[model samples]
Structures are given as structure tokens and as C-alpha cells.
Target: MTSEPAEAEPANQPADLFDLSHNVNFLLRLAHARGDLLFNEAMGDLDLTPRQAALLHAVDRCEGGNISVLTVVTGMDRGTLSEMTPRLVKRGLLDRRPAPGDGRAKSLYLTPAGDALLQLARQRTASLRERVLASMPEEYHDLFVKMLAQLVGLETETRIVHDLPTVTRRRT
Candidate 1:
């Protein structure tokens, strides 16, 4: 008697093995893309990229901070901040001076123009935040931000701070 080979099915497999809609990475990417689109439409004439704005804001908050400090505060790399500083200085939006203790290290500061632009950007972005939050339920607003902060290891940080760095999504 010949016995038929028994078919074995994988145990506990999902109906759709690779469902992107339920993927964290894919969801984060889509959220980022949506944020960028909203920011671009909102910041009509700012011409400042999100990275550039973050750098400027960091300089303003940390006045006289060097590239290394900006990197820590902005979550940007040394190379990108180094490249951006010169361009901002050329545009008269930032000023670079020799660090007080370290002559070789240059400190950064936002010029009057940079500060003004940043203020405008902040206003526009406040509205953008409202729009983004509008999509989710009102009760989840704080929780949503908390969850994001936790994801980025900022859960321990105070929820409200006068100088907390803003995470913008717009770019030129």
C-alpha cells in the first residue's frame, strides 16, 4: 500500500503575511510624507526646509552654541549642520563667532532676520499642528504627542518648556 504524503500547513500564519498597512515602518513613512505635504502647502513662502528651521531654532535657543551642540539639540549630523551654517551666514540669517573657550570651534547665533523668520515659521506651524491634530480624536492629542516622544526617547522630557525644540516637517 502506498501512503499519500501528508501536506503540512504553516502554523499561525497571518492571512496577509506582509501587510504594509499594519507595518510600523511603512506607517511612519506615510505619516512623514503626509506631514511634508501639509507643511509645504502651509508654508507658502518660507523657503526654509525643516532641517534648516530646526538648526536655526537650536542656534537661537542655545545662543553661542557650536556645531557639536547644534547637532545634539537638532538631531542633525555634524556634516549637515556644518554645511548649513555657512549658507545661513551667507544669507545673513546666522552669525558665526569664535567660541569663547575654544578658538578653533565656531559658535552660532541667529541673526535678527533669522529670529523674525523663525517666529513667522512658528506661527504657520502652529496652525499646521492644529490641522494635523484635527484628524485624530481630541482626547488622544496629548497621548499622541506623548507616544511620539516616547518613540524618540523623549518621554522623560517635560511636556511644556519655553525652549523646547520644535519638530517641523516643511522644506524648500
Candidate 2:
């Protein structure tokens, strides 16, 4: 039998090839999980998820804010907002009124209770963000936020109408 030399592994290979802690996708997921954990820990007593709080904030901020406007601002899908709106209404945190021009559409507003809770949530989350940023270097703060915004296309605008491909059925 002929003897051949074994190939050498790359010098820069990681200690564990499967270790994904530094991977972009893995890190994004971990960061999201950590954010949720911290948010829950800070605001769990308020009985609102982060997204719910965001929706309330959006409703308060968006001019003539309705579900469609919220979808654009919050990046939440229509179906999700549709489902979430009623729950908040049930909790007495939101008031849904028929839009002036559109009877079928709803314009959302925060109730007194919702506004109070949202104010508290905003303070807590702001403090939480400060703490989170404190853990990282000051120089990286803006860059970090900018990078995340780019990832999510935070500045992208949604169009009400777009071209659609026509589909034709083939006769068999």
C-alpha cells in the first residue's frame, strides 16, 4: 500500500467549527432573545409585550394613526395588528373608532390607562436601553443602531399599490 501525507487543516480554523456564537444570524437571534428577556423582566408587571407597547406608542405618534398606518410604521403585518388591536381593546388599553372617511377602517387611540402604561413602559425600556448600551463601547452605539436599522430597512416606505404578476392556468 502506498502511503500519502494527511492534509493539514487551515491555521485560522476555529476551535469548534460548529460554534455559532459569532455568526450573524445566530448573534441576531441571541440579541433578540436577550432584548426580550430584559424587556420582560423590566415590564412584565405591566402585562404588555414589547410589540404591544410599540403598537401603543405608534398609535400615539402616528398622525391620524390607524391600523394601516401602524402597519407601515411598526413593520407589523396587517393580520397581526388586526389580532392585537382587539386584545388591547379588551384590556381597556385602546379605543377603536371608525375612521371618518372609511367606515370599514378603524382609527386607534390610547385610553388614559394605555397612555399611562405606555409612559411607564417607555421609561423602563429607555433605562433598559441605556444599561444595554453601557455594556458596550460608546463608540459602537451609533454604528450598532445604524447597522440594525439597515438590516430591517427601517426607512423603507410601503406603496399602497404595486404591479402583480398575472398567472394563467394551463389546460391539461
Best candidate per TM-score, number? Answer: 1
Measured against the true structure, the TM-scores of the candidates, in listed sequence, are: 0.78, 0.77
Tens-digit lDDT string for candidate 2 (27-141): 7888899888888888999999988997887777653467777777677899999999999999999999887788987778889998899889978876788766777898998
Error of 1 at 147 (Å): 1.8
Off by over 4 Å in 1: 1-17, 154-172
lDDT (tens digit, per residue) of candidate 1 on 58-142: 7776778788766766667899999988999999899998888789988787789998988898888788888878989989988
- TM-score for candidate 1: 0.78
The worst-scoring run of ten residues by lDDT in candidate 2 lies at 163-172
Indicate the TM-score of model 2. Answer: 0.77
Q: List the residue pairs that clash in candidate 2.
A: none
Clashing pairs in 1: 49-171
What number of backbone clashes does candidate 1 have, counting pairs of residues 3 or more apart or in separate chains? Answer: 1
State residue 80's C-alpha deviation in candidate 1, in Å.
2.1
